[model samples]
Target: MKTELLEFENKHKLLEPTSTERVATLEAISEYTENFLGNIDTLPAFVNNVSEKAPFIQSINFEEQNTLNEVLKNIRLYIDTPGINPASGGHLGYIPGGGLFYGAVGDYLACITNRYAGVRFASPGAVLLEETVLNWMANLFGYSKNYGGTLTSGGSIANLTAIATARDAINLKAKDYHKAVIYTTQYAHHCLQKSIRILGMDDVQWREIECNNLYQMNVEELEKAINKDLNNGFLPWLLVASAGTTDVGAIDPLQQLSEISKKYNLWFHVDAAYGGFFILTNKGKQLLKGIEQADSIVADPHKGLFIPYGLGAVLIKNKKLLHKTHQYLANYMQDASTEKVDLSPADLSPELSRHFRALRLWLPLKIHGEKPFENYLNEKMQLATYCYQQLSNLPDVEVFNKPELSVFAFRFLHKELPLDKYNEKIQKAVMNDGRVFISSTRLNNCYVLRIAILSFRTHLSTIETALTVLDKSKKIAEDELYQELRNN
Candidate 1:
């Protein structure tokens, strides 16, 4: 039996590579990433060609050992060749956050260490570092040292956590769910509503407050709805606001909304996932006024901070409430139950085990400093203005409201055809052209092209490329759509 065990261990020895083999593997990976980065400026923002049938998928067998070279080749072919190139600066669609190289290095370090970041008892050093960053964010939002937050996978989970905390803080139970009232703008991110459903409060009343001409939440409509709910004997408990909505980048009248929430004793939560980091800019500070008043706020380091797309945060002014809402006890976790030092992340989030996400955010901030990030954010705002100005100058384009942050909607004006149909063709044309990527959304029942300029790598040149591509794609789409109409 001993000899058999020895043989089994020997058979799997390759899993623990020798020093030379480790170096070789690291070199191969570094080379591949270096090449990718070197050519990023030349890569298409979107690729239309998709081929699922490949011998490479069939050829690889996980049971057997594969060389690093083979794996990289497969990555280049099947993984890298098709779909959106998120790392490219030309990825203007949605809100693009550039994958900063320093962040990648931080992620690599995190993976290598494999620390248990969920609890301080397991890794005190890791927890301390995590708290440092979270504290930094808390301060940015005007939260004091007593305030705390949990670093989440993204805005969705952060939002869910915030909602759950709000639920428990209000002492809501299953029976009260039916009578509770929640308020949000129509343009609020769907994740907020989804969180309500997930928290088993779907029976609660929700008011989709109207928006103003700029698509910002109408404070009057929100106030009216709260009063109407009160008159109807429904308890209004929570109000959600968007700092920058996904569709039009509109900021809800936060100060006014905050006052309403306070007057009615409702929990104020801000989904600043897309625009929170903009607070670093002077203009942003003015635009996002009253964000400090939020009872809870969710921000995505990925969207605005230009980290990899995995870090989100939920800041609660009341740390005790956040802690009590998520902490759980079991026999196995007894060792991690000590209450000394900073509160464990496991006590503030749904996750009992989580990756060291702080490293990815911290490394970039430490290496690059806040000045560059602030400049990048301010640049995005400028680029949005520039794009809007250019689009307005065009003979066929119509601009939506001036951009409040780094996104806005516009579309080509078709005099004789269905508006959406022509815009759809143009959208396809732009996506197919594969030079610079942009997205579209329905606004006031019309399909409007959306330009989100958040990627840190996206500079004036990328915008120039987009304009040129838009011109060519517009012509192509017009001809194709007109020709189809004539034939039909």
Candidate 2:
């Protein structure tokens, strides 16, 4: 038995590499990432039709040990090269956070230390760091010191946490779920709907308040809907507004919505996942004026702050309610109960074994300071305005929703082909061209292209390249349509 234990211990020692081995591994990884970043500008943002039978997938057996270089080579070929190169400045599709290098370094340090951030007693410093970060965000959004939040994996979970907190704060019974009313425009991020289903409140009345031409929630219609629900014996409960919507980057009239929520005795929750950190900028602060009135707000550092993905936040004005909703106790956690200097993240969020996510945001803010982040966000808004102007000036283009932040929709028109079909062909051409990536969404049942310019790496030059790509793609789509017509 002593001999067997020695053998197992020797084998386990392999997991902790020698100092030289660690240095070599780090150098190799650094080299690969340096080369990748050096050529990021020239890389294609989108790569279409990556095969499932690629070598990496075929050679997926993990039984055999592989060298570090070999693994990185496979990662470069199979993982990074095939999909949308989000690190590329040309990634204008869907909201993007340009994956800060400093943040990655912070992640490395956090993983190396393996500090448990979920409980205060486990690692008080880690917990305090997280608390400091959340407090900064809360103050940025104009919340009082009484506010509390937890860093989540991303906006989806943050929004989920907010919804759960709101539900519990109101003392909403499960039996009343059928008659409970929640209000938001159609443009609210779909995560809210998913949250409702996950919480088993699918029967709750989701009133999609009408939007004005600018895609903001029409407050008058919203009030009418609330009154209608009340008259019909429904309990109006929550109002979810968008600081920046997914499709067109529309900001609902937050100030108006807050007033209505207050007047109607509804819990006002703002889904500012895409636009919350924009509060750092002067313009954004002005635009997001009434956000302070929200009972709860969801923000993604991954989106607005240009941190790498996996850092999101939910700030609730009432800390006690947030704790009440998610707090749980187990016999194993009894050790942490005595150390109550501050509320642990595990008490306020559904997660108990959460990653040390605060380090990523903290390191960047400390290293670069807040000024650069603010400048980048402001630059994105300017670039969006420039792009919108350029697109509107084009002869055959129709720009939709002048970017409330840094995202908008547009469509290219062709006389011969149906508008939707023509735009679809143009989108395909753009993807195939692979110089810049843009996404498409349907608005009023019409296919339209979208550009979301939030990446810190994105600049005026990148947007100019996108415009050139659009022009080139338009010609390609037109020729393809003509060729098909002739063939038929």
Candidate 3:
């Protein structure tokens, strides 16, 4: 059998890459992709037995393209097309573009090269790449030459670092500290609260200021809270202002907050995680007024620039602030005497073995001029406004918080319906149908539906479809109520 196989191989000469084979391969792949994409209109449900076993590779020899195709097809089916609504909104899932392609290639190159981004001594190029991005981010926020920040995993970690910096700044100034307070709006992301808790400050004061009708941080309330804390002899360590709140996309009055921070000598940090980079847009720059005055700012490219997830930034107006918090020398890590301006990723944040994530953002900015992002942000703001208008006109649905950025909240309202039970059922109804996905929130005693139009793929049609889903859900609820009344 071995001799026969060897003879056959010699005679066939191992099937060189001929035009016929190439065309056949191309056609096979084209058919598979066409089938997957073309069938998206139907969004058909897929069924696969969990216990099914794939054939062994040895059994297939060389021509296993059919088996590979089946695997790809099955995986594609498992992805659940159109994607799920990120607790935020508008799944905008897996967009393919130059930015995404380059980011993938960068990751591939980094993997092939295996550059360790943690230590400057080991991989100065990788560290420099990360630092160049950080410097770019610092400059983008209008920070001074002295200001700097580190790329972080996401908002939670960014917030943690910002608060840690604030803590270190306070600790340096004060000799004895009995109480520490953190001030932020009630609408501030949960990450701030999480950061405060994680810092091991059991007596840490949380001045959760209320929001105004526009869902922005109430400056008057903020002032009152700060004064009360001061009067009570509690140290106000940090004032965290939300550049864009998670639920309603509200940008707190940063200018006012900054003033309060200055007057009170509080560490000013802006959680711009969701909407910071919108700074490129005329409206965003206008809306995020005084964000530059912040001592530190957190931004997420994944949210605004539409880069794939796992990238967030914390920009400090004073680079010393990061050193105040993170300046520690391990025998192997930092050589303080040399003054290496090139940033080692580990020196900036807690993580040591960090991925070269900055290239995902840096390459995109260099490839597409910043103006494109500005234009895209403007379009997103318009889409949010469009969605708000659509939701507002519907009789049963009430547009609760006017969107300050790209996120807005709405809820079904009726005299007879129980809010909790009714909203729960409506949420399920929308999800079960699966044409579009949205999320819910409880705002001011009512269950609210949140629509965040922040994704790069979100367009007019997607907004229209989402509104259609809302309208249908509302009508279904109303019709059911009428039927119940008639039966009763």
Q: Pick the candidate with the highest lDDT.
A: 2
Ranked candidates (TM-score, high to low):
2, 1, 3
> Which ranges of candidate 3 are over 4 A from the true structure?
1-74, 77-99, 172-178, 334-343, 478-488
| Backbone clashes in model 1, listed as residue pairs | none
Tens digits of per-residue lDDT, candidate 2, 1-488, equal 99999999999998999999999999999999999999988989989868787765477687888899888998888888887988888999988766999899989999999999999989989999999899999999999998889999999999999999999998898999999999998889989999999999999999998899999999999999999998999999999999999999889999998999999999999999999988999999999999999999999999998889899999999999899998887898899877554689999999998899999999999999999999999999999999999999978888888998999999987776888878899989999999899989988788999999999999889999999999999989888988988999
C-alpha lDDT score of every prediction, in listed order: 0.90, 0.92, 0.72
Q: Candidate 2: minimum summed lDDT over ten consecutive residues — where?
A: 51-60
By lDDT, the candidates rank as 2, 1, 3
Worst 10 residues of 1 by lDDT: 57-66
User: On a 0 to 100 scale, what is the lDDT of residue 312 in model 1?
Assistant: 93
Compose the digit string of candidate 1's lDDT tens values, residues 337-446: 86734679998889988999999999999999989999999999999999899999988898887899999999998788777888888889988989888999999988
State the local distance difference test value for candidate 3: 0.72
lDDT of 1 at 327: 75
TM-scores of all predicted structures = 0.98, 0.98, 0.81
Which is superior by TM-score, 1 or 3?
A: 1
What TM-score does structure 2 among the candidates reach? 0.98
The residue-level lDDT of candidate 3 at 471 comes to: 68
